[model samples]
Target: MDPLILGALVAVATIAVLFSGVSVATGLLIVSGLFLVLFEGMWALELMPDKFFGKLNSFALLSIPMFIIMGSAISSTRAGADLYEALERWLTRVPGGLVMSNLGACALFSAMSGSSPATCAAIGKMGIPEMRKRGYPEEVAAGSIAAGGTLGILIPPSVTMIVYGIATETSIGRLFLAGVLPGLMLVGLFMVWSVYSTWRNTGLSVMSARSYSLREKLEILPRVIPFLLVIVGVLYAMYGGIATPSETAAVGALLCLLMAIVIYRMWSPKSLWVVLRDSTRESVMILFIIGAAGVFSYMLSSLFITQSIAMWISDLDVNRWVLLGAVNVFLLIAGFFLPPVAVILMAAPILLPIILAADFDPYWFAVILTINMEIGLISPPVGLNLYVISSIAPDIKLKTILKGSMPYVGCMVLAIVILCVFPGIATWLPDLVMGPVR
Candidate 1:
């Protein structure tokens, strides 16, 4: 069978599986296995190289599990709750203050955990209840958290960045650094939007301006310091070349465990067991999707599909910026139905080559790609963050989640345009901090 036909068939099968309500990992594995059988023939296994699995065995890949463990440990501990309290106390004095604080805390927590669901779960638990107690509307509480949770991917130490770097062979450390300004920018955008929206809606009441005394503000510092330490420690180790990304993750995980057990004293035997169990389950799910993506990507490469697609795209007469806009449109559409990781795995292989062939800066292109994926997280019909928030706040209809997310989605779009116009926003910091990539 022609590999192109086989590739299309695989693509179609993947879409079918995705819509079938089957797990994506299972879908990917099934499709990959089918491709292997159809293209390689049943007895052609010996012709396949061992290198397929080798791609999955990177030290960088180890970061995924360590980061997962770190996120789980932090979420399971009382540290997340404490951090939220500190943020609430500090920000509650402003208009729409609690929501702004939620966004800020989500951004900070995102730097620590690097996973969206973890960010949502940790902060949503605290932010939602507090917002409700403060007489904020349920929609406002749920919407802010659902939208803010996406900062996890844009912020540094982001697992998504690690996955993106691994997929594209870009510098993971530099990618991590690149996210800082944009992440904060997005947080600021969200805060602005929250304030604006709250102003428009008279139903939402602002918290009274209660000033925190120096002692009270100082008291919250103890809770804030641990998270600060974790962030500093991880970034210092990675940027200083004292540790590779995976090693930084391992250290971060250990630090989180220590904070949980020694400082927070939440690491009861049962709690530890539960954390390990959840981590294992999440890790297995992620690894399986990655492994299956590896297989599918391999088959795509074997068919020269990426090269063909790149050539076809490059041959177009349109301006390069126009072409990039088109690429963003493509990714946005893909994000509506595809998971962010799946979008990266499937599109990066094809798109990176095209961007490079066009002589676009790799770092700039990476930031662009990252922003597009972030938008996907909030897109309707199938945005994972939306579902996570909806599940947590079940009373809020999907339509409400979709409606509430529009302003943040617009913010992300504006962010993408900013990065597009000023590539320096993404590239300059990495060069300044890490020196120019060789």
Candidate 2:
């Protein structure tokens, strides 16, 4: 079969299987095995073990589990609650501050967790109920937290960015550094929308139930500030050449667990079990997808489909920006149905060469792709964050959550436009710190 036609068929089949409710890892594995047998012959099966171990055997990949463990530790405790409570105490006097606190907490928690669902569950469970109690609209409370949670994959320690670095053979540290500004930019954008929406609706501020004294506010910081410092230290370690991501993740995970234990009294056996169990489940899920994607990538390359597609796109007589817009549309569609990590694993490889061919910086494109994934988290049919929020705040109907989330979705789209206009927002930090991708 012609490689182009075969590639098209494989893509359609993969999509069909995934949308048919097959697990992503299983769908990719089944597709890879069937194709290898029919085309490469059954002997290809012999090489599968090496492929699995080869992809699974990365030291950098070890960071995924460590970071998951870090996120899960705090998430399984009152740390998220403490973080939001502190923010609420400080921001309560400001208009729309309750919503602001959720977005802010989500961003900070995301910096620690690096998993969108984890971020949402950790922050949303506390943030949403409190927002409702303070009289913020269900949409504002649910929408902002859901949107803020998407920041996990765009922030430092992001599993999605790590996966991208691994797939494209780019520097994971640089990728982590690159995401910093764009992630903050999204948070700021989301905050702006939250404030404006709240102001427009009623100017009815969601103040704290009672005023907080200076001492009261100061006390909350001891619990929250250490976690913030841990985030800063981990970022510094990666950027300042103090540690590899895996090393930073290991230390960060240990510190977060210790904090949860001492600060929140989460050292009990069941509490420890929840942290480890969640870490294992989520880590296994992501790593399994990575392994399967490796085989899928190998099959595409071996069959010449990857080359054929890149060649075809290179032959186009269109403007590079136009080509970029087309790629964004493709990503938007893919992200609408697939989880961000899976989307990154499958599409980032296919898109990287084309992006580089169009004179785009890989790191800048990482931000753009991550923002697309953010849109996916709030979108329906397969919006994992949507489901997460639903489970967290079941009283808020899905439609209400979707309605609240749409404006933040618009903010993400605007953030993408802003980054496109000034690509430096994504590239400047990494370039200055790392001395330009070299």
Q: Which candidate ranks first by lDDT, i.e. highest?
A: 2
lDDT score, candidate 1, position 290: 75
**Candidate 1 weakest lDDT stretch, 10 residues:** 43-52
Q: What is the per-residue lDDT of model 2 for residues 171-239, given as tens digits with 9 covering 90 to 100?
A: 998888888899888999999888888777757655545678999999989988888898889988888
Q: What TM-score would you give candidate 1 relative to the actual structure?
A: 0.92
Q: What local distance difference test score does each model get?
A: 0.78, 0.88
What is candidate 1's lDDT per residue for 84-110, written digit by digit as tens?
Answer: 878878877878888888888888777
lDDT value, residue 85 of candidate 1: 77
What lDDT score is found at residue 95 in candidate 1? 81
Candidate 2 ranges with C-alpha deviation above 4 Å: 205-209
| lDDT of model 2 at position 319 | 99
